[model samples]
Target: MTDDAPNSSTPPGLLPAGLMDLLPPEAEREAVLVETLMAAFAGHGYERVKPPLLEFEDSLLAGSGAAVAEQTFRLMDPVSQRMMGLRADTTPQVARIAATRLGLQPRPLRLCYAGQVLRVRGTQLAPERQLPQTGIELIGSDAPAADAEVALVAAAALAAAGVPSVSLDITLPTMAPALLEAAEVPPALRQRLARALDRKDAASVAALSGEAGPLAAALPVLLAAAGPADGALAALAGVELPPAARAIADNAAAVIAAIRARAPGLRITLDPVEFRGFRYHVGVAFTLYGPGTTGELARGGRYMSLNEEPATGMSLYPDAVLRAAPAPAPRPRVFVPAGTPEAALQALRAQGFATVAALSAADSPKGLRCSHRLVDGRAVPISKEG
Candidate 1:
């Protein structure tokens, strides 16, 4: 066949560049993973909540912190003059619910949701911006128990996702903030230090903090203290924690201690220099990653008393979790008719095989490499070399 360059004449369906179609097996695998995570959160008393994927820009930005706002996909509302946006993050929504609607219901609210978010940001890594996110937000309760519950739920979620050997990168959001404030670091200098600390670039951390004043003097030592959970906390002692920072540290330690005591074998690392990731992460922000990876598999943190109209919560990046998920075994194939999936399913059931609607006719047996197909518009028979 002669090579023909693609042009605009190609159907719009064929032009979906940053989008993907998940086949039955992949979709089923994702469904299973989401289900498993939901169960884990539910077990810990986090009730399920479904926040609207589409919201008025005002509502979405109601209490969303600064950094999170940068990630939203802004658009104009056709029905009204108001600008609108797809929620880039759901934690603020969760926070609003807890502070307003759920205020009368309970002092502490645990809610989780699975939703699709469209990121306008260029997907340099994956070339796909829209993805599913299943996350939980812990609101109302500032107690260490709440943090522990979140940690436990996160670990269980990873296990549910079939991730092997999850190593937690635990950090105290208050640490860096606390250090900057106590050291009386200049606003300009603190910014540079934050970046260096995130990259774990010791030279940069020193260089930036070195000129900030007395605050920069011991900054290197404190940052170097980052390691195992307990060790990091110990190193923090020399850092001079104000009451707020001390409280943040105490809460984190309690959460970590409980997780270790309960699970015993789970590995947790502490990075005290870790700054707040999402602008909403006020107290303790943490991320979980497996060995040999630089990106976070799952991340969340505490943001207590965010706004008067809302409260505390966390948002799990389901897309990240999905990315980190091990490829599951192929789902058992069930072929069905493209025209009449019902008739085909009825026939399949009669033949003793459970069946579902066929997603595409391209899977017909006679079609290109179509290993699975509905024979005679019904009946499911997985071929094998018997």
Candidate 2:
């Protein structure tokens, strides 16, 4: 082969779309961010749990898991000859554990988990197929207080991860459906209206015929009502909603009130007609955003766990969190000359120095990207010009 020709035997560094390696400081930073968030959850009495990366297709896709079925990757199991699936989300598995193995634990189970999730594809906003998730699940509670607690804890965890100015946008996923059901709109019109509302297309919604009765009129108002929490609540109160939709609004108000009482300074907003991306949330749900972040930093809401247990939780995307979080300060690395005492290395490590021992006299500390060098068993700063 000519020297200019491509080498057939050489492997390329190309990774599959929506997937890439996390190298150096970034990988370490993500690990630290996960631990920091987990510690915050633990502080709030959320014990840690680890779920398997794979499970039987039936069990993995049961109940709420059905929401992500399209994103799950499935394969036939060799031993059982049954279909198995890699987890696309950890929340369902956590719920499964709460309903089965830990069913008898307590009335309100608090659990936190951190792990990697593999999805078949990615969304327009989040185009990464492999992502790290750190989150907490508060199960067996239907109280609005449970919702508030989860939101607050998630905010606190994000704060601990060094994300500043985090804001919560609360949404009533069921309100629109409840309104439509009460108005008894035709199926075809209902689907169209729903699509319009999901897209937040006010012009399209207004263009729809007013023949749907109260629902047709109420939807545009609800869409307009989305704004800062206080004002939106006032607008919702003015709307003459059906009994079921009214109840949902009331529940949302209560949850928002609880959150405000606990975290008075938290930035809160409301969207009464947001029915997209929350497939299984039966009650109030919320999306968290950090200043300068592209997409949601975390999201959670009330849902029915396995065996129909009431549950609420939040899942933080570490990739997004790392983006919003302040850049981590690089750790000091110290180079130790050859034949350095093992005890000296241990001492440096005890002081939080990342020691890089020299393999030979020719190995330069600067070449190894070390910030310091060990001399007489002490870490001495290395000149940048060296």
Candidate 3:
């Protein structure tokens, strides 16, 4: 073969990095999970909204969407002759719809969405360029109650989706930045300190305290305050923060209080100094984890809508959710012989059996991978030994 010729051993079905075909029950399971989450949101008065997968680059990366700009995949639109981008996340699209399409709607408009997001690259932990997301947004409200509602709704949705032992880790993304600003830390030092805090490097955080001043001293306290909800809240309360940073802490406290009041049994944690992965969150932010999951099952928080309306939302990763959720029992598949009446096949389907009609006499139930077979116009279980 020539040097440029394709390798003969390479599988024709091979996909690019960070992409794959979801097969069989796995695809169905993800679909069901998405619906389960959407149902949970609908039950709480959140209406569903669907946005196009691609949009003009300018609009797609506007406002809060700008946060994911680097991750978005851009291409030129043949018709409009403008740059178009695939969404890296769904929140910005929902925000855009709410601001422009539904701008005249009522306040505190609750909207939910489910879609696939394509990113140019994936994180080391996730490593999936295309991800399915189902989430909700509550726009035009900045109250602590609104924040609590989103968090609570997310927990309830995950529970409904069968994610067991789910824990919510709440963070104040602006807390560390506010502290650095209040301390009058230089721009370069602020960036360094922020990086240290993001990595949870206690030694570096403490080392920078001298130059960061009194307010910076609170950074270490904030870092240590990360833990179970109650204790973390207490530690955060004890720290003397500047006004801006202190207000952020208070808002977090109120939101936590509301959540505790409703879901006292929920496992909640507070990370006051976590400033990473929340580029647009101006207030409280959170991540959801389940037992046995590799990374976060979901993440979201308070952010402004496209029109600057206050909004908070959460997005669940159905792929991770499926890994965390219990595997659903597979539906029985029934094999129908060729020449079976159309009515009989319809009846089998109506009875909840997946009918696989044989095209030839040689096809058997076992060969068709079916658990049952149609005989005498009735569905009967196929014997394993047969």
Better of 1 and 2 by lDDT: 2
Error of 2 at 84 (Å): 0.5
lDDT tens digits, residues 49-98, model 2? 99999999999999999999999999999999999999999999999999
Tell me the tens digit of each residue's lDDT in model 3 across 58-151. Answer: 9999999999999999999999899999999999999999999998998989999999999999878778899999999999999999988998
- State each candidate's clash count: 0, 0, 0
lDDT by residue (1-386, candidate 1, tens digit) is 33685554666567456667778666777777888888878887889888777777776776553456777878787788788778777676676666666768766667888777766664576567677777787777776667666766777777876776677777776677776787788787888888888888999888887687665565687689888877887876666566766677777778788778777788888877677466656666767785565356667877754444323444555556666777764533455555664655666567555455555755544343333556666444456541
* TM-scores, one per candidate: 0.80, 0.95, 0.95
Ranking by lDDT: 2, 3, 1
RMSD of 2: 2.5
Runs of candidate 2 exceeding 4 Å displacement: 1-12
Prediction 1 global C-alpha lDDT: 0.69
What is candidate 2's CA lDDT for residue 133?
Answer: 96
Clashes of 1: 0
Better of 2 and 3 by lDDT: 2
